[model samples]
Target: MKKWKAVLTALLATGMLTGCLGNGGGSTLNSESSRIYVTEEGTFQTATVESYVQQDYYNGDELKTFLEEAVSQYNGANGQNQVTLDSCTLDNGTAKMMFHYASPDALIGFTTQYEDKENQVESIAVDKLSEVYGQSESEGVTFIKADGKKADQKAVSKRGESQTVVVTSANPVTIQTQGRILFVSDNVVIKDSHTVQTTKGKSYIIFK
Candidate 1:
């Protein structure tokens, strides 16, 4: 009886330790706290990336105009198009823009040209409506798929030396990292779901 009791106590202690370690593994990227606005005028939605820094990276009005112009151009060229800017906001430490398209093909067309345009500001944009899952790596960015495939992806250029990670996907994703800057171009639904933290240079999540 004495030996059995000792074994049970040891097992319980091990379980507790495992639970604590599991909880400390990764951080969540929640999109609920971001400032999101939706409107029928052009069927547009806008959201700002919630960040530790309060300073605005891009002029909101200017970005709105840019997106509006892009939509006009796309509509003029395509006769059967329904793609529109879903949201544009500054989150994390970078600028991010998202667009909604009627189909995957439409998204492809817009990404080809809009992504190549020369601009004074550095920002990330999604060609189609997507849900991005990302985690910061010490060397660069790492993306993981729902089926456990490591995705090969790169970040959009930044104005400064700081590195940025951009991940776009149609399905929800899981991220594992210590902490890094990320700018998402789609609606983000944090896997585990946690509060957004705003400490300069600390780990946090921002959805655009």
Candidate 2:
């Protein structure tokens, strides 16, 4: 099986659900879209779900084997254990799978192997917002607090230097990081204290 379709076939085959992207991860078992969990170390895991009517020829066991094999091959080629198939299951016309990667790039590399663009999610983690999104944009962008007030520049700057800023773009992804979220860009919608969602353009998550 092609590495690109590994994430797709596992989810879209059954038309189930999907996962997430960011320097974040979570234990959420079910999500309408992809939910990604990232650590301070940059390691991350994604839980994807897809659901569709089950066809008579669909064999859950065979699909699982094929997915595991693909994961093995990818890990072997990309460095042992760089990517792992944490789980894959198909039940009652729903498919759910989780993948663990050494880094967000590893996950991106695996999902976006196809050139034509399927399951293409790009994510990067930087120590500061200026590191990736640039100093000009970082300084100019206004982030909001959980209370819905604009984040002050002094506080944002104080934590900006030590914060982990995760910038990612995907098909409606939910991103969670281990650090406390301090601010987010206009494109980012705060889902919780540590989780956010972005649909258009690049989304930024600045956390301390």
Residue pairs in collision within model 1: 49-90, 49-91
Give me the candidate number with maximum lDDT. Answer: 2
Residue lDDT tens for model 2, 1-208: 3443455555554434433333433434334455666666556776665655676666667667777887787777888887788887777876666778886678788766522122346765556654544553545666677555787766765664645555556465667666767787666788777777766556667776
Per-residue C-alpha lDDT of model 1 across residues 76-194, encoded as one tens digit per residue: 88855556876655445444555555543454456445532211012222221123222234434333322234434443222123222233333222222223323322233233222
* Prediction 1 TM-score vs. true: 0.32
Indicate which candidate wins on TM-score. Answer: 2
CA deviation > 4 Å runs, candidate 1: 1-57, 91-93, 116-208
Q: How many pairs collide in each candidate, listed in order?
A: 2, 23
